[model samples]
Target: MKNLLIKLLHHNTRILQILLFFDLVILALHLTFGSTTPFFHLDFEQNLSTFYQSSKLIGFGMIFFLLGLSRQVKLEMKSFILPLALGLIFLGVDEWFQIHENIYRVFELFEWLRPSKVVEASMSMGYHSSLWILYYIPLFLIFAVWSGYWLRYFQSKLKTNVWVIIFSGLCFLTVLLMEILSSTGSYSGATYYWLVTVEELAEMLLASMLVFIGSKILSK
Candidate 1:
């Protein structure tokens, strides 16, 4: 167990450093501002927002890192790298600016720009239009373009890519499940706090995982 721990630490030293940096920042914020102050607030500069922003930034970095690696290896599927990087760049910007939410607001302002009557009626039937149009559609398009390239990359190097896949899955689960639950007010009191903590921690973990993946690619 001790040997395994030592090897794991040695292998993931960069990830550990990134995680430790965020941990200390969060800890310092909580200690200075009071315990509940950092957790319950939804301010733009709050801990939760910072975590979200950091995760997006890390994701942006990871895409470019992968692009560089693909170039270095002279990979055949290098054509997709620029698009993937651009998509991640947009994601990072959207994360910080809430661009999708702004799109919804813009549609709301111009009635003619809103969805059709059928779509609006469906939305009234507990169907979230934003879920379909705002998030799912864009993600589906991006994934559709990238999935085959990613599959080929993973097939060629399963062990190294597995960590990236796992962390990406975690980020997806946290955003799709935990964030949705929090938005829906599905938990209260302590449960809500715990949910928020888990969601933010997942974001942090995802960022760390991206750093680890970048390190792995660079090492190779």
Candidate 2:
């Protein structure tokens, strides 16, 4: 039994399956109990949020491990590893604190940052006018510039790297686009639950994919 457990632990695919199983369980509980009830706030308090944070931490650890390994690989790879690790660290911090949301409130304090017609339209449609332009857009631009510098590194292992990009892109799309649509007070009942579920599921899949990609890199 111990040997079986150890073997499973060493298999990254199995590990991801276990994580997925837990996510499903949590989702089931949330749907059954509702978000406000203590029985299952998993979507917000325990499951999705926790998994998202854990994935960022795992990314940080994987990058750090790769940093050490890169020293023996090549100079260019070694140089890329540090910034990548730092970026993961920043992501972990951001996930924990929801820094972007806070930044939005800070922007809201300034009279000059009044809501635009688009923002007004979104709010009128039952969505939040959180001003993505003020916070998330700028942060995304910075991330894009940083990632652009390491495009070659990402393409180093083409297949796994592409999966990484695909999953990561999906995560951002859900967070930036799907989330906005869901927040619009327009969605209620089953539609609302399904929308939020998809958003959280995207996050979990992205994190799991990153872990799988990291494991492949480590094995190589």
Candidate 3:
């Protein structure tokens, strides 16, 4: 499978170009038709754009899994790659199923495990905050730090702009932040719609960036 990925991506110029082009098309659609229309918009869950973004993450995860399988990468690198692959794929599934939001049920089922008033009060900051963010943010920080750990490897191997990757993670985190803000009713009406649209579109764009980076690294 690693060999197949290498063979397919060794001639990657056009594929990356097409993927980047799709990124722009998605953005245009989200801002125009997607923002106005309910059927295909990104702001709503269970929509096509949402599915595409989630699937993109899962696919990128597979690319990393293949890279981990490759004997070409150093053993220490495989240790990192395997976890990243699992994280991406799991997050994709979480997006599709909303595992983070649904975790509220778990706390309900197991009351003892739920956050104490102290924790919730500390997290609240005088606003009604979603409990999911309470659980997810620490996990998110861990993932972000783990991802950032490999920048030196990719930067040296692909000679790619590390900022692009950093920016992608920023965009990804922005989606999370915006969701928290949205749930708090910090913004609503058109402001809410546009903020969600932009952040979700940024997320889709980030997914594309990772796939491109993974492909680039494999091609090298």
lDDT of each: 0.54, 0.59, 0.73
lDDT per residue for candidate 2 within 1-220, as digits (tens), equals: 3344224335766766766686677667667775577445534543455655566555545555454464354566555555555656666666666665456566566666644544666557765735553356767787677656555555665454575666676786776666666766677767877877777667666555555544444334
Best by lDDT: 3
Error of 2 at 84 (Å): 3.5
Q: Name the lDDT value of residue 128 in candidate 2.
A: 74
If ranked by TM-score, best first, what sequence of candidates would result?
3, 2, 1
Q: How would you encode candidate 1's per-residue C-alpha lDDT over 1-220 as one tens digit per residue? A: 3333324434555665666587556644644563457452433343465655546564646545455454353455344444555555665666566675555555555666554553567567875423334435667566655755564564554474565666666675675566656655556766765566566556555555544543453334
lDDT of 1 at 176: 53
Give the best candidate by TM-score: 3
Q: Model 3, 1-220: lDDT tens per residue?
A: 6777778777666666776687677667777787568657776677777677688779879888977887898788777778877877987988888898778667665665565653567566774666777767678788677777776656787555566677777888787777767776777588888777667767776766666666666677
All candidates' TM-scores? Answer: 0.62, 0.66, 0.83
Better of 1 and 3 by TM-score: 3
1 or 3, greater by lDDT: 3
Off by more than 4 A, model 1:
1-17, 20-77, 106-136, 144-148, 160-164
